[model samples]
Target: MCAHYESPRDKALLKKHFAINLPSELAKRDVWPGYQSTFIRRHENADVGDDAVPPREALLGSFGLIPHWSKDDKIARHTYNARSETVAEKPSFRDAWQRAQHCIIPAQAIFEPDWRSGKAVPTRITLANGEPMGLAGLWARWRSPAGETVHSFTMLTINADEHPFMRNFHKPQDEKRSVVILPPDLYDDWLQAGPGESGVFLRAWAADELQAL
Candidate 1:
């Protein structure tokens, strides 16, 4: 699970890459579960008609996902990552997947542990080209008893036991896995994807395009 990652602080790069204007300045940090972060997705308001232009927007949201029907926020700690193989069948992610509530979680880098030395050594991973990585995710909106609305999301991950670079992380005895990082060209497609077409983008990213520090 990718529990920590560095959110990009360069607003210019975010505008240039995602083509959306941010409502406020975002601070840079090694984001963890329960932390507020930025994400890009199509506007959910019905007022924004389907035929209207410029349907996508960037918004601030919590890192962990909370299903609309969840009784409390504690479930978020375990819902931060939804396994690709069972996302559509899992109770926490099934509704979001079925409704096509897709999103892109931009990151400057992601932190992982290297256990080769018999002890965990922290390492940061980023794109070899130095561009921001857009991780595939699913967003949800939960209404609290007090009528407050909470927005949260979960990163989608797939088994990577055979991947050259991703397979290097995690315990040697545990199943290797990696988050789905979408290419630049696929950002819009992913956000607008239907339930039937979303599965096509859930594969492992190219290893040669990434660098681990």
Candidate 2:
């Protein structure tokens, strides 16, 4: 479910790779669902017309998704991940997906549980080349009861039963699944993709690209 991850890279690296400023508060070693983290998305500026390019910006948002119609924040705990197969139809993610509110979550590594030992053991997974990677996500904007706007996001996941590496985690009896980690070249395309075309990029990442630590 990708409940936790590390984003310890420096701001300079984030800017160099994603071309956006990293918020000071998000410059931390670890990020968890329901916590404020950095995400990259396109935003329309008032001065720019619809025909102009929407500026790509890195902004702070909670890791779990909060639908625009959500009455409270309690639902966030279970909406941190949206299954790719059902994301377009799921109540929690349907609106964001239909509206094309896509985003990229930059991270150095992700933590998961290894159940081979009979007891769950925490394991860290990172790129085989030790580089940062981007997880495909959906973002939402909700108006709080206090009239403040709250932004949140959720990672997109897919069945990974056939994956060589990803299938090793989680409970043995549970369906194996993994989050979609986009390649560097697809970052811009994913962020700009329409709802109909977004499915093309939701497959599992190559097993060779990851290393368990």
Candidate 3:
């Protein structure tokens, strides 16, 4: 699974690619499990017939999802990636998955460990076309003890044991996994999909579309 990634930093690029304008001040480009970053999702009021509201909106959220039942934000450290096989049954991810709180994590690249040699080496992976990646994820809201509302999200991952390119990542003995990289055409379909329809969009990306460096 991806534990680190480079979030897109160019405002124009984000606007042009995702169709949302972010704040002048942006989160750190390098995102980690508990770090804050931008994610795109369907606007809450999109169906309310409000012409003023755009269909999609961008917001800053924790990279790791913080479930509503959590006592604190520390749970983020372990909830950063939700396995697709158990996402609907996992306590930390079930609520969001069941509710279809889908989101898109725009990234320039994701880092994974290459264990081809005797030791681990960090490798960067990106789309072969060099465009930003719209990774499929789930978002959730949590209320802090201080009465503040926090937003968080987690990337959805699928088994990559049989994948041509992704099977080469991670430890040789470990079960290979890869994040779901959504195609541009399916962005709206993913965000609007219902719980029962999720299976339609959770397939692995084409290996030939990605390159690792």
Candidate closest to the true structure, highest TM-score = 3
TM-score of each: 0.94, 0.93, 0.98
| Residue 80 displacement in candidate 3 (angstroms) | 0.5
Q: Model 2 Cα displacement at 212 (Å)?
A: 0.6
Give the runs in model 1 whose Cα sits over 4 Å from its true position: 25-28, 45-53
Q: Which is the better candidate, 1 or 2, if ranked by lDDT?
A: 1
* Runs off by more than 4 Å, candidate 3: none
Runs in model 2 deviating more than 4 A are 46-54
lDDT of 2: 0.86
lDDT of 3 by residue, 92-192 (tens): 99999999999999999999999999689999999999999999999999999999999999999999999999999999999999999998989989999
- For 36-104, candidate 1 gives per-residue lDDT tens digits of 889889876624666655667888878989999988777877888999999999999999999999999
Order of candidates by lDDT, top first?
3, 1, 2
Model 3 accuracy (lDDT, Cα) = 0.93
Better of 2 and 3 by lDDT: 3
Ranking by TM-score: 3, 1, 2
Model 2 poorest ten-residue lDDT run: 46-55
